[model samples]
Target: MLKGNREQELIELAQKMIQAKSYSGEEKQAAETIGEFCKANGFDDVIYDRYGNVIGIIKGNRPGPKVLFDGHIDTVPVSDESKWTQKPFAGEIVDGKLYGRGTSDMKGAVSAFTAAAKYFAEDTNRDFAGEILIAGVVHEECFEGIAAREISKNFKPDYVIIGEASQLNVKIGQRGRGEIVVETFGKPAHSANPEKGINAVYKMSKVINAIRDLVPTEHPVLGKGILELTDIKSAPYPGASVVPEYCRATYDRRLLVGETKESVIAPIRELLDKLMAEDSELKAKVSYAVGEEMCYTGNKIEGERFFPGWLYDQDEAWVQAVVKELNNAGFNPEITQYNFCTNGSHYAGEAGIKTLGIGPSRENLAHTVDEYIEIEQLTKVCECYYGVMKALLV
Candidate 1:
């Protein structure tokens, strides 16, 4: 376990991260802080990817499996700052917990992984054959796996360990997610005569009702897929007296294994097609939503909203190795799964790489107001990460 000064240093690093408001598109300061910490702790190589992901490498004398410890630097914006009893960025400690934004969601785990790397780097007796990479990625809050996908193009790894909150348990996989937009088109006319124009909003209500009745596929491990209508809007806002020409409904769909972009979208498309065929005046279209954005480093990324789900078999060697390490560390290791998504969508889901997740905080506290992580759990995570690296590489 990390003790004394090392433990204190981990806490301080976590505090520093909490102080930086690296929300989604604005992760520059957090990336720099993590990068600087890596350099100061004797990392063999430190680099910032074109998209501003901070990567720290510790090369070994002999070659073995390439292992990556992944964590995102970006966090969801604090929704209601007034609801927070403590200063969100102060990293205040109360009852042995560090409270702040990104503390439980991720910053704490990032600091723990960095501390683990430092311990390994400073150990004279440490001998390993492989590469250890710690990546502090951006854009995970807004775009689930795009940044990690960018990082993978440069540094592909044999195994990926995500540091998202897992309550110190090991997570095998998560349900995939995708965004879909259902749009209804109609003729615009002055609101004075309702019969003169087809009302798109009126047509869209039928589509929304159909979607609400959609029964999702199910998986034994990942559980049932879910569909939630997150947003709905009509064009020509603040109109004095005009029929809206278009109406759009956005949905967040959780996918299970064997569910693809085509499968997830097929039902909605069919519903729209049927509705349009039934009424000549009603026209509607369904398609996956696409996100196009520029990163903090001025890198452009564009992709469909689908973030695929994945499950790593518990019997896999790398998984068993991690579980063994956790068990040896004096903790009862339990195999769990994340209810939300992470960078695993890129690594394990899309790239088909072996991946697992283990970290320091409860999964439920990720984006809530006044987030916090246990100080003792942080140290334990550090030790387990270091131990797992040694076991896997040596």
Candidate 2:
């Protein structure tokens, strides 16, 4: 067991991480803090992957499966810090809550797991089996699991633990996500004589209405495959008096297990095909959005917006053992799943590795102003992660 103010040390590290201002593209300071903490602690090795993710390792006495604890360092931008009661980066504690950006969205879990890994090593003295790897990942705020491909490459893990907020519950799976773009084409003409050209907005309106009538798919546990219209745009803003020639609509598509890029949008594609065949004036297409961003290390990270949904059987031996261990440790955590997308989209969804998420604080607290993780939550999550290490690293 770790001696002398271990909880205080965990709080200090979490505060440092919050103060670092690690937005999506910039995580250097937070990464450095993690690296230093790992080195100062009992980690056997610390490595920075190509995408600038910091990976800290604890090797056991004997050969066994490698278990990875993953948490992203990047946080969504605080659009207005002045609106918050506590300073967004101050990491202030008021009435037992540690307030700051990323505290709940996930820097807190990063700190918790890091401390747990350190403490587990100190307690066991390398007497256990297998290895524990903790990673502070980059660019997760922008791309859920894109940067994690690098971590997967560097450390081929037998299982992954994503520390997204779960309020101390064990997450078995999550609904994946995809950004689908639909566009309509038309001819631009003077507003006074609308018949002279096709108005793209009008064409898009028909497509949008048609989409509303289309039924979404469903899953037994994950709920519905929702395709909600998030936003729409038209070309030539402030057109003064011209018919818009083009229109684009972006839909936030929540996915189910076994969903693919092609499968996710096939319905929309077919709808477009039918519309085009019926009305020559209606021309449109649907595809998954692609995005790219620069990492703090200057490496480019990019991927298709499709992240597959995944679920693991609750009765699996390792998963059951973990649940039993937590229960025996006096933590009656509910066996649940994340409603939102997580880095599991990569590990479990894409890479086919087993993945689960369990962390401190409520999922609703993420990205909200005056975000916080209770001190009780912070410390318990650390202990829980230590419990997880004891359960899985054998």
Candidate 3:
């Protein structure tokens, strides 16, 4: 068990991080807090990127592999504030649970990693083998895997510790995700002369039905690929007497390990191809988000299908190091994979870094109203983080 004062400090830090409202695209305050903590704790270096990612480094007296503690400080937007028992940013601690918007989705992990880094630094005079880095990234929810992509270009590490809620267990892999868009076009005509005009909406309805019956692809770890229709829009203003000329639909697709962007988009593209065969006016395309922003519209179209799925062998040395430390900390750690996507994909997939997911809290509680994390569990995570750092360093 953690000492009483250590537990209190852990809770206090979790609350502090929770109190800072670091919603996506507005992570400056939380980034500042992390930077300040790193500076005050005597980190060798603390830096922030233009995208508001906060990175703190603690170099070991001896040199070896570079291990990174990765987490996202940004959170999903909170709605229905009235539904929460405490203010989302108040950082309330009730009945041993720290409650706030970012509590479970990940501020707790950020705090845990920060405290663990401090612990390692305090014992820095001891002999160690590697460098430890704590990275609080931004724009995770808005743009998946973008944070680590940027980090890899600069501070590439041998191993990445993704600080997502895994009940302090070790996560070996996760499925990939992609965004898809399908559009239909037709000639517009007055409603009174409906027979003279092809209704794009009606044509799109057929494709939507077809997709509804499409089964998800299966994977060994990630379970299955899923397709969800997220957005739909029609061209031209809705009028009582006008047939729609264009219709567009957007889908969010979760990809498994064996699944590729082409595989996910092929079925839908095939649907559009079938439509095009019958009517040359119908058209569709599949794409992902780019790193572009417009001031007025904030329209970020799909950029590239670069986010890939990856896995770290649980028996690898780095993973064994993590398991040994976790076991020493009284956790019978289990090997698992995150059901959702994370920056780990970028490190392990794009950058070829050995990355594993480990943090506190139940994965299901993330991104929900009344989000909270167990103070006891967080304390354990701090110890776990400390042990992992010490094991790698020494």
Candidate 4:
């Protein structure tokens, strides 16, 4: 059982972190705070990696598969401050809710795990396997699973728990996200004499419509793959007297199980080919690229044109362990999925590690002006974390 003051300490820390406003690429201050908490509490091997991920290791008395608990320290950028009922970073406990940025999306989970770290350190009633690794990772909002890949290079674990907003339930799997760009070329001509120029925008319009017409594949657990036009740009003038020659559009593709790069790209490529076949003048081209942007921490991340989706069986030991623990603790664990992306896809899809998600949040509250978490929920999450660790490690 967690102490009252312990739960309060976790809430206070999460609020402080939210106030720091550690956006996707700026998680340094919060990471430092978490590192200090772990060290002050006597957690061993507390360390921060090159990517700004704060980690602490608690060695078990015996030996078994290593269990890792991960949560991103970053939060999505806040919207208009006025839109929030309370100051977004106040961490105020108003009517039982801790209102703040990242409160629900994740800082709450970090806080819960931090509390769990303290609980495991002080608790003598339970004993178990290998070790418990608590990871306060950076940059989860943007690229979903980049942290898993960046951190996995150092600590390879047998089981991973993603602390996303799961309302303290166990999440077996979730859909993946991906991105790519489409470009089209045309001859530039004076608008006064349209015959002298080919309009790339005109050709692109057909392609965009075709893209909308193609539906993505769906799954029972992971749902459907979706393609959204995130951006569009035109090169050359579209002046009253000039015609545009080149155009490009970027796509945000969310992939589910059975949806691969070939499966994702084929339909779009087919559309372009069909247009070209129908009209020799319609010379539209399709291309794919990754988003390899840099952060303040200098971690260069490359996101796919589409984020691949994944699913873990509910009966799997990884899932069952957490579920059983939650049940034992009087929590009727709602076994579900993360509607949004998280580090799970990367761990389950790319790294192939068994992963599950349980956290103190509701996914919808994330990225909204009303972003907040129930203080009680944050506390409950700590208990859930401790319960899962106790069950799995033993």
Point out where model 2 deviates above 4 Å. 1-4
Q: How does candidate 1 score on lDDT?
A: 0.88
Candidate 3 per-residue lDDT over residues 1-394, each given as its tens digit: 6677666776777888888887777777888888988898788899876566789998877778888998998899887899988789999888988899989889999999888887767766635777888998887876667766767778878878888999988899987777777777877899999888888888788778877987777776667677899998887766468898888888777776656667777887776677678766555555554454221113332236446777777888878987997787778989988888898778876677888888899988998889998888788888888878866667
Cα displacement (angstroms), candidate 3, residue 176, comes to 1.5
Tens digits of per-residue lDDT for model 1 on 1-394? 6778998999999999999888877899999998899888778889998889999998877878888999999998998889999889899999998999999889999999988987886783446788899999988887889989978889889889999988788899999899999999988899999789888899899888877888888999999898999998998886569898899999989988768899889988888888778889889988889998788888786788999999978888878887887787787778978899999999999999888998987888888888899998899999888877876887
- Which candidate ranks first by TM-score, i.e. highest? 2
User: Residue 24 in candidate 2 has what lDDT?
Assistant: 85
Clashing pairs in 3: 128-393, 129-393, 288-302, 288-303, 289-302, 289-303, 290-303
* Two-way lDDT contest, 2 vs 3, winner: 2
Candidate 4 TM-score, true structure as reference: 0.93
Cα error, candidate 4, residue 248 (Å): 1.9
lDDT of 2 by residue, 44-148 (tens): 999987788999998999999899999999999999878999999998999999999999989999999999998888888888889999999999888888989
Ranking the candidates on lDDT from highest down gives: 2, 1, 4, 3
Q: What ranking emerges by TM-score with the best candidate at the front? A: 2, 1, 4, 3
Query: Candidate 3 or 4, higher lDDT?
Result: 4
Total clashes in model 4, counting residue pairs 3 or more apart in sequence or in different chains: 9
Candidate 1, run of 10 with poorest lDDT: 120-129
lDDT of each: 0.88, 0.92, 0.79, 0.81
